[model samples]
Target: MLSTLAMSVPADSNWINFDVPALIQNFWSATFDGLTFGAIYALVALGYTLVYGVLNLINFAHSEVFIVGCYGVFFTLSFLGFGPSVPNLDFWSIVLNLVLALVVAMVASALTAFVVERVAYKPLRKRNAPRLVFLITAIGVSFSIQYLIFLWRGPNPEVALTMFRPTPIFDVFGTIIDSQQLVIVLAAVVMMVFTDQFISRSRTGRGIRAVAQDPDTATLMGVNKERIIITTFIIGGLLAGAAALFYVMRIPSGVQYSGGFVLGVKAFAAAVLGGIGNVRGALLGGLLLGLIGNYGQILLGSSQWTDVVAFVVLVLVLLVRPEGILGTSLGRSKA
Candidate 1:
C-alpha cells in the first residue's frame, strides 16, 4: 500500500523539469520561423491597413497581387538562366539580376493594383453603390486574378532561383536559418523604414492622410483624391511585391491561385489585431503574431497547432481590446 501510494505521487511533480535545453531550442526555432513569416505578413498587412484607413473597404484580391509578385520574380530569374544555382554569373551580374527581379515584381504588382482599382472600385465609388457591392466586387476580382494565374501557369508549380552555397547562419543549434532569411529580414526592415518616413514626413504622405481623414474635404482642399487613392494602392502593392520575393526565397516553389489567400488572411488579421490604419501597430501586431504562432507550436509540440494558435491569439486580442493594442485611428475617423 505504501509503495503504491508513493508511486501514485507522480514521477514528475514540477513542470520545470521538462528539459530546459529543449525548451530553449524550441523557443528560438519558433521565434525565428515566426519572425520570418511575420516579416512577410507585416508587408501584406500594411496594404490592408492602409487601404482600410483610406477606403474602408478590404481589397480581397490583394492576395493574388502577392502571388503575381512571386511569379514575376520567379519567371524573371528563370529567364536569366538562374535556378537553384547559376553557373557563371559574376557577383555584379547576380546583383543586377536580383535588383531587376525585385523591380519588375514591384512594377507589375503596382500596375495590377492600379488596374484593379480602376476597373472594380472606381465604378463602384462613382455610382455611390452599396458597400456590399464593393465587397462582392473585391471577391470577384480576387477569383478572377486567381483563375488568371491558373489559366496561365496551370496546375503546375515553378521553383525559384536559390543560391546553392551554404552559409554560417545555419550553424546555430542544428536549426538552419538560411541566407535568404537574412536578406529578407534586412530588406523588410529597410522597406518598412522607408514606408514610415514616406507616410510621416512627405508631402504625398500628407495628401494621403488628408484624403483618408475625409475625401470630400480633401477634394475641396485640392488634395487630388484620385491621385492619393492611386498612390495608396501602389504603395500597398509594392510591399506585397517585396513580400512575394521573401516568400519564394523561403519556400522556392511555384505560385498557386490560392497560395496568397492564407498569407492575405493572416496579414489582414495582423493589421486588425494591431489596430488597423496604424503603421506602428501593424509592425507590432505582426511580430507579436509571428512569435506567438511559432512558439505556440513548440510549446504544444505539434505543427498542426500553428494555425490554431494564430486564430486563438487573434480572437483573444479582439475580445480583450477591440481597439487593438496601439488603439489609434491613424488617418481615419472613428466610428
Candidate 2:
C-alpha cells in the first residue's frame, strides 16, 4: 500500500518551485542587489548586538528605531522641496539634501533609542527585572510604536521623490555597479568599521567591554553602568538611522507604518548568524545572508519566498556552527 501511494505521487510537483537555471542566469545581479539590502540589515543588526552585549536583552523594539529614522528621512526631504515628482535641484543641491536628511534621521533615531531606554528599559533595570520581563517590555514597546505610526500614517506607503537617478559607478566583471548600490555598500562598510574601531580602541569602548564581560565587576571598576548602556543604545540608534536613510534611498516605497518588521527580523537573524553576541560577526552574517537570500529567491522563482529560503539557510548554518561563522566576540574577550 505504501509503495502504491508513493508511485501515485506526481513526478512534476509545482508546490515547491526550484528554478535553478534562472538563479544561475541572474546570479550576478542578484548578488549585487543582495549586498545592497544586506548592508541595511547589517546596520540594523548592530543595534541588536550592542544592546544584547551590554544588557543581555534582544531589544525587539530596535526595528521601530529603524522605521522611525526612515520617517525622519521622508519628512526631511519633503521639507527641502522634494516631492513625488522629479527634482530639478542641481547635483550639489541633491548632495546637500541627502546630507541634511542623514543628520535628521540620525538625530531622530538616536533620540528615539534614548527614550526607549529611559522609559521602557530603565525602570525594569532599576527593579532588577528578570530577563523575560525585559524581553516582554521590548516587544511591548515595539508594538506601541508600530500602532502609533499606524494611527498617524494609516496603512499606505509613503513614496518619496527619487533622490537621484542611480548612475553607473563602475563595473565588476559583468555586473554594472550603480550609484545606489555603491553608496549603500560603501556607507555601511565605513560605518561598521568606525563602530568596530570605537568599540575596540576608545576609552568609552573599554568601559563597554568591561560591562559586557562582567557587569557587576564593571560597575565596581568605577565604570558608570547606566552611562555605558545609554551610549550603547545611542550608537545603535545612530547606525539604525543611517540604515534607514539608505533603506529609503534604495526602496523609496518601503516607508510605511510597519516597514521595519521584516527587515528587523532579517537583521536579527544576521546578528545571530554571525554570532548573536559579536559585533564583527553581525557584519559578516548580514552580507552572507544577503547573498544567500538573493540566490534563494532566484532559485525559488519568486520574491515572496525569499524569507523561506533565507531562514532555511540560517537553519543550515546553525546546524553546522551553532556559535555562528565568526563566533560571539564583542570588543571584549569571547563571552
Candidate 3:
C-alpha cells in the first residue's frame, strides 16, 4: 500500500507533509494511544512467538484466528442484548458481559487454531515437508480462512454495539487515561505475564522449550511432540482471541473478514523486532512499534505513513541488531 501510494501520488510538495509542531503537541496523547495499541500488538505477538518457537513456522493464518475470535465476540455481545448504542446496565452487569465476551472469543479462536493445526498442518508435518512448503501452506490456509469468512459475512465490516462507555479512569500527566484503554492495557499485561510464567515455570512449558531446542531428543525423552504442538497453537489462539476482544473494544466498528491482515503484519513485525522466539521481546517490540508508528503519523501529518515508518524503523533496528531487541531464543533461555 505504501509503495502504491508513493507511486501514484504526484511529486508535489504537498504529498509528504512534515509537521513537527503537531507531533510535539500530541506527544502525550500519542504516547497513551500507542500503549493501548501496543498492548494489543503484544498479545497478538505472543501467538506468533509460541508457534514460531516450537514449529519454526510463521502461522500467517493466526490473523484469521483473531478475526474468528472477533466474530465470536460480536455474537456473544449480540446475544447478551447489547446493541449499537451504550447499554444502561449497572457496573457489575457490564462487567459480567465483558467477561463473557472475553471467554467466548478465546474459546472460539483457540478452537480454530486447533482445527487449522489438525487439518492444514499435521499432514505436512507427517509428510516431512520442507520449510518452504510449510510457509506456502500457511499462506494458503490464511487465504482460505479469510475468503471463507468473506463468503459468510460478505465484505462489509460489522460494527459491534458499544459494550461499555469509556469514562476517565485516571490522569497521566496531561492525558486523561480512559476506562477502555485502562482495561485493555491491564488485561493484556496480565495475560502476557501469565503466559510468561507458564512458559518459564510449568512442566508443559519445559516440554515446549525442550521441543523447540531439540525436537528429536525431546521426543525420545518422552515429551509428546504432537501434544506440545497442539498446546502451542492453542496458547497462540488464546492470546490472539484476547487481542481481538481488546481491538473490538477500542474500535467497535473495525470487525471484518480481512481486518486481521494489517494487525497480523504489525504483530509479526513486533515478534521479529523483539526477537521472534523470545517472551519479553514480543512485549518490548510491540510497545516500541506502537510508539514509533503513532509518532510517525503525527510527525508526517498522515496516517498513511504510520506503517511505512514502523517498517523503516524495524529495518533500521535489524541492521543494528539482527537478533532483535532481546536476543535470546525461548528454547535456549536459562532464565
Q: Kindly provide the TM-score of model 2 when superposed on the true structure, using C-alpha atoms.
A: 0.94
- For 229-275, candidate 3 gives per-residue lDDT tens digits of 99999999999999989999998877899999899999999999999
Whole-model lDDT, model 1: 0.79
lDDT of 1 by residue, 232-320 (tens): 99999999998887787777764666788888888888888898888777777887788877777655545566778888999998899
Name the regions of candidate 3 deviating beyond 4 angstroms: 1-11
Residue 44 error for model 2, in Å?
0.3
Model 2 segments beyond 4 Å from truth?
1-12, 331-335
| Model 3 CA lDDT for position 55 | 92
TM-score of each: 0.88, 0.94, 0.95
TM-score pick, better of 1 and 2: 2
In the range 1-335, model 2's lDDT, one tens digit per residue, is: 44334434436765565666677778889999999989999999999998998888999999999999999999999889887776888999999999999999999999999999999999999999999999999999999999999999999998765888899988877789899999999999999999988888789988889898899998999999999999999999999999999999988898998899989999999999998878898898999899889998777666777888889999999999998888775745442
